[model samples]
Target: MKKAKLLAALGICGLILGACGAEDDSKYDTSTTEVSESEAVVKEPGLDELDPAVSEELSKMGTDEEIDWEKINFNKRQYKEYIESLDEQETDSSETGESTLTVVSSSMVDDNTIEIVINNTDASEMSELTNGFFAIMMDTFSRQLYLNSDYSDGTNQPTIIIKDNAGTVISEETDFIEMEETE
Candidate 1:
């Protein structure tokens, strides 16, 4: 699935970026925006204004019955600005190439849990590699949720489940990854 590939690629890139250290963000200064009390309060853009694809995905972020729409909708302006800020950065995909760990599907199973199914690849120590990817992926994924002021649950870190190609969950929990022993 293209979505799976894109998410895996993003996770890989996120790992690379973490090792590379934080980039200089001084160019985008917010000090100038010192609106006085007399200035009218401006209304920010809603989720409707975001890229349809992203908006749709974020709209379905939380629970099915009582989705995170309320929280996400309240911060549509924040997400819009966040996405726009990301677009400002330039990245070359050719440098990263392809990721060895293929993600079958990364789904949000609950408000505080993310289930990621990764296909078994030729990489040695598959479990070890999967654990590493899980940490990186969870950390990266949590940032988006943690960005929302209203999202306060599960130690402020969503639990991540990693599964093998056969759709068997091999790892569960977060921060500290615990693998399920197989026969």
Candidate 2:
């Protein structure tokens, strides 16, 4: 269940990032020099190697301010592995205590968009479940792509709407938080 939630959060973040657009400022060649079948020379530019205009445009695209772009892995294999690790973080469920969150359901609407229904086990709204489990979620979902509008302040209903690349809402979930009092 935890893994499912984390994957959903990551999908949400990726979708949000995909929605941001940045104009290309540089026309640098990306072709590789073939030395051999297994040893082609690739031009992997680091963040510092990018033109100032290009860097500025990327920064504006909601890239995390905390990310050290210089240290990013340019290798496709390594990058994919790093992303997998992020989604598979180890958590001691027994030591973590009871989860206040109850994942009602989740589904992917497209390649990028996903919607998750979260229930606050201890409170009527998720705004009240902003403690233990909330912290865990926030920590795990600390992607810069998360917009302020993605969350509720307890004053309104909780809804998750993930959009496609064309800015069309692919997944829309309403009433994720139950508001009824149990007898």
Candidate 3:
């Protein structure tokens, strides 16, 4: 009878141990699935150059004064240097355009990408107008360009430009304005 009881207790302990082992395996399987899925979705850029025209445009849209430009972390020095050089070039190029108005600001999104905002004028209805203008320009360039007007401050006004390694505008330029503001 004692032997029978010992045998029954051992069976119960074996069942519990088996269930615990199965639970551990399930956790490891779930973690592996998540890692593999993430690896599949994250696409890296193929090119490492920036278009001079786009760089010039971004430069004119100065860095957000309230946000520090030097401290923000960037994935690549080439990307940051391109943005800085563009801003300096835009400032120098402004005198060349009598009717064209450009405001520039830049922020780092991660190690790989930078967000550039450009605004043309101060009118309340300028957001859509500017965006449409940029969209056409991006289409003409045959690149994917993104337009993000909602990202701007009330005073600074925002128009976002996104570019990939081919220096192709991956986002639509929905934030460009061609009309001159009236006095």
Candidate 2: residue 119 Cα off by (Å)? 3.1
Instruction: Count the clashes in each prediction.
Output: 0, 0, 23
TM-score ranking from best to worst?
1, 3, 2
Comparing 2 and 3 on TM-score, the stronger one:
3
RMSD for all candidates, in order, please.
Answer: 23.2, 21.9, 16.2
Score candidate 2 by TM-score against the native.
Answer: 0.24
> What lDDT does each candidate get?
0.54, 0.39, 0.42
Put down candidate 1 lDDT per residue, 39-139, tens digits, no spaces.
Answer: 96767765447546446556563336433433443243454344334323322122355434455555556556666655544455555665466545444
Model 2 regions more than 4 Å off? 1-99, 102-107, 124-183
- Which candidate should be chosen as best, given TM-score against the real structure? 1
- Candidate 2 colliding pairs: none
Ranking of all candidate structures by their lDDT, best first: 1, 3, 2
What shift in Å separates residue 104 of candidate 3 from its native position after superposition? 1.8
Number of clashes found in candidate 3? 23
| TM-score winner, 1 or 3 | 1
The lDDT, on a scale of 0 to 1, for candidate 2 is: 0.39
